[model samples]
Target: MLVLDLVATLVFGVSGGLTAVRLRLDVVGVLALATLTGLGGGWIRDVLIGVTPPAGLADWRYLTAPMIGGLVTFFLHPQLDRINATISVVDAFGLGLFSVAGALKAVEHGLGPLPSTLLGLTTGVGGGVLRDIVIGVIPTVLRKGELYAIPAVAGAGVAVLGSRLELTTPVVAAVAASVTTGWRLLALWRGWTAPEPVRAAAAP
Candidate 1:
């Protein structure tokens, strides 16, 4: 579980750093994005549960991970830019892992199903939201199409249900994360989308 958490943080930090490079942000912006992506979800989760200061703020390892991510990206931007698909793959994996982790942690903390699932979504999507907001764009989760938060919710739901079925925690986490990542990749490859909202008729 500790390894999974670190991997998720690294992946998210890399994704955020890549986005910052695309936006031509300065080093500060890049570092900020990496930090936010690496720490934002857990920070939010802890805060909501009344954990003061948050683990990320208190833990040097978490803080250092994103710094390393930012430095790697800063030096490798040109090479990484040539392979945007690679970044997408990493981001998808991070999303799945974080979502499952968040859901499991929430349940461990005695949260109910709905809130647990929501926390999972927030964990999966929160970093990207912060990254996009930094770059002044609406989040991809709110846009017309994208697997994004939908897969997070689905993944978390599966994990939570499995928990109730007495499945081993590791097995549930693995299955949920794998399914979410698969769904996201398939959505990207095939352009899957949810139905768009139908606007109500204008006053007439």
Candidate 2:
């Protein structure tokens, strides 16, 4: 589980750095975005639980994960620049993995259904929100329409519910994550977005 967390963090960090590069940010800006996106969710979770030092600071791996991700982006900027589609694919996988991990950990800590699910959503989307804010764009979650948080909520719910049903943890997590990832990617490919309401004209 720890290894999975680290890998997902690195993946998100790389994608975040890629976003920064696309925005034409400087080196410092790029690293900053990567690190923040990598650690923001864990940091938020730790702070919420009053965990001293926060997981991001206590674990060297957490700090190093984003740095490595940033380095990857730095060195592979040219390749990544021409591969926007690749980034989206990788980002979806990262999102699903992290959502499962976050929800699982939250349940382990004794949170109930709603709170645990909320934590999962936060974990999945928090970093991306921070990354976007750093680069001066609205977070995807807050935008007109995106399937991001919806799928995360679905994945988290599945994991938590499966645990309550006494299923194996690893299997539950994997299934939930896979489902979430599949749904998100399909939505993206099909341009599935929330419908905008039609407004009535003002009374004459």
Candidate 3:
């Protein structure tokens, strides 16, 4: 579980660092943003689950991964920018992973299915929300045109259901995460857009 957490943190950390780089932040700012984006969701989860002092803070490795991510981006932004096309793929994979991990943890902590699903989504997107808000941009998960949260919800739902069904942990997590990552990738490839709210006609 810690390994999965660290992996997701590293992935999110890279995205956060890349955002900092895009905004021309110095190394300190980059690391700060990376730390927040990498561990924000897990922290939110731990708090909701009544676990004081989240894993990211308690476990040195969790913090270390994000710092490494920041350093990589800080020094190698040019190489990363050159391969920018793969960035979204990495981000989507992390989203799927986090969602599954979140849902499983919630279940382990005795949360019901509905709450677990929601927590899964939160764990999947909360870090990015923190990153975006800190950077003064609308969070992608809250934006209408993006299919981000939908896939996350689907993945979390699967994990929750699988847990209830007594499936093996590894199987449930892998399948659920794959569904999420696959759906998100398909949306990206196909330019799929979530439906937007229609404005009501003005009264005459």
Candidate 4:
């Protein structure tokens, strides 16, 4: 879990730092955004699950991954800029990994399937949402016709079902992460979109 968590953190941190660089934020702001994007979801999950002090606060690695990400982006963003689309793809991978990991952890902690799944979704999107809100942008998960949160829920559901069926954690997580990442990547490739509220036609 720790390994998966840290891997997810690094990718998310890079994405966050890239965003900050694209927006021309200062060094401190870039670092701050990267840290929040890397650890915010885990912190929120830990707090809600009664893990006080949060891993983000207690673990040096959790804090350091984002810092390194920020530094890398700060120094290398000009080259990184050529591959913005690639960053989004990596962000999708992080989303998948985190959702499965979070759901499995919640289940381990005795959370019910429903709560575990919901918490998993939160864990997947919370960091990106935080990063977006801090930068005054609408969260991608909440955007109209966005295809983000549903993939998270689907991935979390797989983990929840696997747990209920007594599957091993590693196997279940692999399946769930694959489902989420594949779905997200396919959606991006095919321009698949979530539903948006329809507006009735107005009288002329």
Best-matching candidate per TM-score:
3
Cα TM-score per model: 0.91, 0.89, 0.93, 0.92
Instruction: Answer with 1 or 3, whichever has the higher lDDT.
Output: 3
Q: Ten consecutive residues with minimal summed lDDT in candidate 2?
A: 194-203
The lDDT values for all models are 0.85, 0.83, 0.90, 0.88
Model 3: what TM-score?
A: 0.93
Question: Which digits, one per residue and each the tens of the lDDT, describe model 3 over residues 147-191?
Answer: 999999999999999999999989999999999999999999998
Q: What does the lDDT come to for candidate 4? A: 0.88
Q: Note each model's CA RMSD in angstroms.
A: 2.3, 2.8, 2.4, 2.3
List model 1 lDDT by residue over 13-114, tens digit each. 887888888888899988899999888888888788777788888988888887788878988988877887877887788889988888887888899999
Residue 194, candidate 3: C-alpha displacement in angstroms = 1.1
User: Which parts of model 3 are misplaced by more than 4 Å?
Assistant: 1-4, 200-204
Worst 10 residues of 4 by lDDT: 195-204
Candidate 2 vs candidate 4: the TM-score winner is: 4
Compose the digit string of candidate 4's lDDT tens values, residues 1-204. 677667778778888898898889999888999998998888888899998898777989889988888888889988878887888798788899988888887898899999999889988999989999999998978987668889999999999999999998789899999999999999989989997558855766
lDDT of 2 at 200: 58
Task: Rank candidates by TM-score, best first.
Answer: 3, 4, 1, 2
The number of the candidate with the highest lDDT is 3
Cα lDDT for residue 169, model 3?
85
Q: Runs in model 2 with CA error above 4 Å?
A: 195-204
- For model 2, how does the per-residue alpha-carbon lDDT over 43-155 read when each residue is reduced to its tens digit? 77767756678877788988999878888898898887788787778778777887777888788888888877888888888898888877678897777667788888899
